[model samples]
Target: MKYKHKYSLTPIAIAALVAFPTAALADGPYVGVSGGVVLPEDSSNAGEFDADVPATPDFGAIPAGTEVGWETQFDTGFAISGQAGYAFENGFRLEAEVAYSEYDVDTHTGLTVGGANIDGADVAILTRGAADPANPTVGAVIADGQGKVTNFGLFGNVFYDINTGSAFKPYVGGGIGYQWVDVDYMPSGVAVGADEDGTFAYQLMAGASFEVSDNFEIFGQYTWRDSTEEAEIPLTLVPATLGVESSQSIISAGVRVGFGG
Candidate 1:
């Protein structure tokens, strides 16, 4: 009698077997590169002279009461970034990234010496005249200018992947970091430069990815990023400090390569 011998796998053993493949698929290191378009919100600032300068009696230059208000609109620009990260079997990931972006100036507005709001072109004329010794009547000039804002950021991010047992994965993430921001303006033919260092920065992101092979994937993402109020930049004669605030949204697409799982 070849008596039948019965054997059964335990629940734990079954679970282990089912999870083995998922663990292998989820554990790995990856590197990615992305490029995108940046759409900026408006940036604005107001400034006044730190101190009034007394005129020399001989020169007869009266103290100029100078104040300025500035508003700048930005055009769409380009953004690029690189990241490296590791994924876990529980669908969590961590990454470090570096990014760069540039935005063009669309418009600049200013306050005039005559206590009226003026266009940038008129401000430029006032600024030019204020710099000339012959045009003593112009107390202050605001200039319309063209320039670019460039920023570099470094961030540490965390994400969660919604794996649906298919080639496609969707994810959501957020990050906090530091940024170096530089603003260069050619206002009234005079160069004005300002920079902020180690400003607090943050971002929110969401995206989906398609696996192309065992070691490669492609993705598209949308992100919103912002920095804390920037440090002040000094301006001419009146010793005014200019302040700027900025933020933007971005759409990006990229490729990623995985290392061993």
Candidate 2:
């Protein structure tokens, strides 16, 4: 009886020492801010013109030896976001975040099939020469020329927590969302369209949280997202009426805040 009593007391003592501190460490309701570079993993724009379109302009053979080279490049920019969430004692929770990002692309094309290197902007100017109120064809023809492209979008996110333990918490989550896009073509100076079509966008996120002081903690996270957008081009200089589609993958890191348990 004495030995069994001592053994029961040993188990009770161990539980008292190990369980109390862990219960006391758990907290909730946090908010945080994070800013970083938005890197594009796979970004591309591709489109072709429709020669069958009535607005299609005529291009005659030009002199030989004209050199043309086409190039497209997008500039990197900064992104900042804010997050709020509730941290639980268990290894699970929920979070909401809002983020804003910008990407600017400049496109240049020089096509020299023969000796004639075609200038897309110059074609717009020439097509305008045949301008008349009765003949709106010139405007339509000029608008068909491919020019500059600018793209921007807004995003919202909600994620499920998978990590909540010890001093360092690790988690894995997935989110479904949408992006609003604005696409504009050159020469026309008008927005071809905004892709509010609500196409599906998804992300994979992984990060760790370091407990700063129960209610407060510093966290670092990385996310991978896949999305797509499109721009329209007039058929003036291009071989056909063209629509350019850009496929984008973005990776970003930032901190977040917590609240409510």
On TM-score, the leading prediction is 1
Clashing residue pairs found in predicted model 1: 123-142
lDDT of 1 by residue, 39-155 (tens): 988877666555554444233222344665567778899999999999887889899999899998776665443245644232224333333434422223223456778889999
Model 1: worst 10 consecutive residues (lDDT sum)? 135-144
lDDT value for candidate 2? 0.46
Off by over 4 Å in 2: 1-29, 47-71, 106-166, 184-198, 228-253
> For candidate 2, which ten residues in a row score worst on lDDT?
61-70
**Which digits, one per residue and each the tens of the lDDT, describe model 2 over residues 1-261?**
455544345887987656544432245666777766555432233444333223324334322222222334445545566766665656555556665555554433443233334443333323423324454333343234333333233344444444434556666766555644344444344333233223445566777666654455566677665554334444334343234444444445555544445
